[model samples]
Target: MQLERGVRTVKLKDLPEPKPRPSTEGMTRITGRGTSMLQSKPLINIVNVVASATIDQRLDLKDVQKKFPELEWNPDLFPGAVFRLKSPKTATLLFSTGKMVCTGAKSEKMARNAVKTVVQKLRKGK
Candidate 1:
């Protein structure tokens, strides 16, 4: 079979017989007289997740900032307003076109929750 690009073709019969590996099921490898090498499980963690969403209707950033005094919006620095939530610990960017980008969430569910929470807070401003 051709395994790689610009390489020679390997025939099935030309290959040496594969040796069977010793089963290590429920057993550890002994390196020293009393020391055994045990396989370790990998550590994995979800640190951050980013999610974006769009509201159909156009938004008035000034009006939103007026209603929610806690929202940070400076036209000179950025066009989007920063809405921060403490529960899911996320910051969502709100634009005049009604587009939102939520960041600093730990997982997909937390990202969705943060977006939904921001939407709900905006709805309450009306």
Candidate 2:
């Protein structure tokens, strides 16, 4: 089929109607366990929320690893210790510089909770 740009053209077969596109007009952030209330299907779903925090003092990665055996730490391979939480299902990277980067959280509240949990566990070891 050839379509003319400037001039008019005619075809024997009628043109089919264009399909309606999925709308994201009423889309908003999800709250609690339920999804956003929209006329059409949800256009967005939050898979991961990354958050960062820092402490005042330096962290002893070696001692932290020893204290929390569940924490995965290999200074030779990676400088940060991976501390995973079960409740929020988040992985927080703990560095010697007292810096923390949390990932795999569904929401900001969940990310904050995950970081708080990790900090509490670290403090308990001291």
What is candidate 1's lDDT per residue for 4-48, written digit by digit as tens?
435677766677866536554555555788576857554578798
Q: How do the residues 32-124 of candidate 2 rate in per-residue lDDT, one tens digit apiece?
A: 665545444635788899999998789999889889889899888999999998898999999999999999999999999999999998998
- TM-score of model 1 relative to the true fold? 0.64
TM, every model: 0.64, 0.66
lDDT of 1 at 16: 83
Residue pairs clashing in model 1 are: none
- Error in Å for residue 89 of model 2: 0.8
Worst-scoring 10-residue span by lDDT in model 1: 20-29
Candidate 2 lDDT (Cα, whole model)?
A: 0.86
Q: How does model 1 fare in lDDT?
A: 0.87
Extract clashing residue pairs from model 2: none
